[model samples]
Target: MDENEKDRILKVEIDVSGKLHLTPEKKKFTLIYRTATEVHWNTEINTLYSPKPRDWTYLEWFKHIIKVTKEECYCELNITEQTEWVNIPNELKKEITKAQQWL
Candidate 1:
C-alpha cells in the first residue's frame, strides 16, 4: 500500500460508542463503521511478540468479529431475533486469512 493508504488506515477512529470509523479511498460509501469489542487473549505475547497461537492475534480476532457484525447489520431479512452477541460465520475464516496479509 502507498503512504497515503497507510496514513488513512492509521487515521481510523473509534468513537465514544466504540465503533471503528473507516473511509476507504474512492469508495462510494462515505461512512463505514464497525462496532469494536474487547478480545481476550488465550495466551499473552512474550517479549519477542510470540504466542502459542502465532497465527491468531487479538486484533485479528477483533477484525473478524467486526466484519461479521457489519454483514449482519446489512442483512435484508432478520430471520432470528436480534441479540447482543453474534454468530461468527465460517466463511469469515477465509476473509480473515486475506485480512492478515494487509493487517
Candidate 2:
C-alpha cells in the first residue's frame, strides 16, 4: 500500500459536541461515527483500526493500538491547526453555547 492508503486506513474525527469518532476513510460516509459508548473497550476499537486480525500477539496488538492512535491524534492536531473553519453550524454552535451555561 502507498503512503496515502496507509494513512487513510484509520482516522479520528471530532464532532460538534467534542465527541471523538473512529472511522475508515472510504467508509466514512457509510460508517459515519462510532461514539465512545458504541465502542467496546477492547474489541471494537481494535477492529476499527483493522477489521481483520493481523496475526499479532496480544502485546503486539496493544503496542500497535497505542502507536496508531497516537499517530492519528497528532495528524489531526496538525491538520486542525493549519486549517480554518469556513463555516460553523449555527444550531450546533447554539447548542454548545447553551450547554456551556451549566458549567
Per-residue alpha-carbon lDDT of candidate 2 for residues 11-100, written as tens digits (9 for 90 to 100): 333334433334433322223124321222223432233222245432233234334443432221112222222223555334433432
Worst 10 residues of 1 by lDDT: 41-50
Q: lDDT of each structure?
A: 0.29, 0.32
lDDT of 1 by residue, 1-103 (tens): 2222111121222334433233222222212222222322112210011122246643454464344333433311111122122232445434543563543
Instruction: State each model's C-alpha RMSD to the native.
Output: 16.3, 14.0
Candidate 2: where is the Cα deviation over 4 Å? Answer: 1-54, 75-103
- For candidate 1, the lDDT comes to 0.29
TM-score for predicted model 1 compared with the true structure = 0.25
